[model samples]
Target: MNDNSEIQDVELAVSRWLRIGVIISAAVIVIGLILLFIHGGSGYPDDYYPHSLSEIYSGTITLKPYAVITTGLILLILTPVLRVAISIWVFVREGDKLYVIITSIVLAILIISFILGKA
Candidate 1:
């Protein structure tokens, strides 16, 4: 197809995925909040919460409202990262090396920030 059409298609696909991700994240958070209200608490001590992926995963598996909320937050954080990674792929596929490089750097920095934030 024409370049403009192709670009529109890519944009639509990316936009759709981003929308889906955000909707799912918001739904999860809402569910978690409902559970929290039903249980009358976050299921964690006032000063304690899931601080790691594993902890969040375990807590979610156990149906902990706080963990579910944290999982939703993580999903929200990851949605943009997913979009950037997709942009890198689209750039590579279109033979746009400069954007590929720039997008890759952005992804790398995002990952580094996450790691450092955890540290």
Candidate 2:
């Protein structure tokens, strides 16, 4: 295939994945909100919320509304990171060394920040 069509294919795949991530995140948040209403609270003390990934995961497993909402928020935050990762893969497949290097740097920074932010 020509470069133009190849580019379009990449864009389409990226767009589709982004859309899916957003829709899933929104749906999860909505479910959490609905649960909050039904439960009449966030299932946590007032002004308190999960502070770590583990906490969030445990709470979500327990069906805590606040934890569920936090998980949705995390998904939303990671969507762009996923896009960056996909770009790295695409660049590698296309044998674009320069872009692959740049995208790899970006992905590394994103991952580093994500991990450091947890500290």
Candidate 3:
């Protein structure tokens, strides 16, 4: 169709992806909370806290409530990262070097923040 229509479609797709990410994240969080209440937490703080992404994934696979919660939190945190990545792609496709650079910087900062926070 027209350029405007194509642009709107891309925007709509991006929005839809964001909405899906949030909804899935929220659902996971709710399920985790429900499991926590039902099972009384994956044996409390004295037992364990997932130390890494892999651990959380493993825990989630094992149906550990805390892991499920952490999985949800991680998903929520990564949603914006995903969005930024998508935006960068869109900017590149539109040949907007300025925005691509800006979005890349933002993404870099996000990664740095996470790294620094862990350290």
- Where is model 1 poorest over a 10-residue stretch in terms of lDDT? 42-51
Counted clashes in each candidate structure: 0, 0, 0
Ten-residue region with minimum lDDT total, candidate 3 = 40-49
> Looking at candidate 1, what is the lDDT of residue 43?
89
Tell me the alpha-carbon RMSD of every candidate: 1.1, 1.2, 1.9
Query: Whole-model Cα lDDT per candidate?
Result: 0.93, 0.93, 0.89
lDDT of 3 by residue, 33-59 (tens): 899899986834676688887888888
Off by more than 4 A, model 1 = none
In model 3, residue pairs whose N, Cα or C atoms come closer than 3 Å (at least 3 residues apart or on different chains), thus clashing, are none
Against the hidden reference, what TM-scores do the models get?
Answer: 0.96, 0.94, 0.88
Candidate 3: residue 1 lDDT (0-100)? 69
Clashing pairs in 1: none
- The positional error of residue 111 in candidate 2, measured at the CA in angstroms, is 1.1
* Backbone clash total, candidate 2: 0
Point out where model 2 deviates above 4 Å: none
Error of 3 at 74 (Å): 0.8
Model 3 shows how many backbone clashes? 0
Model 2 lDDT, full chain set: 0.93
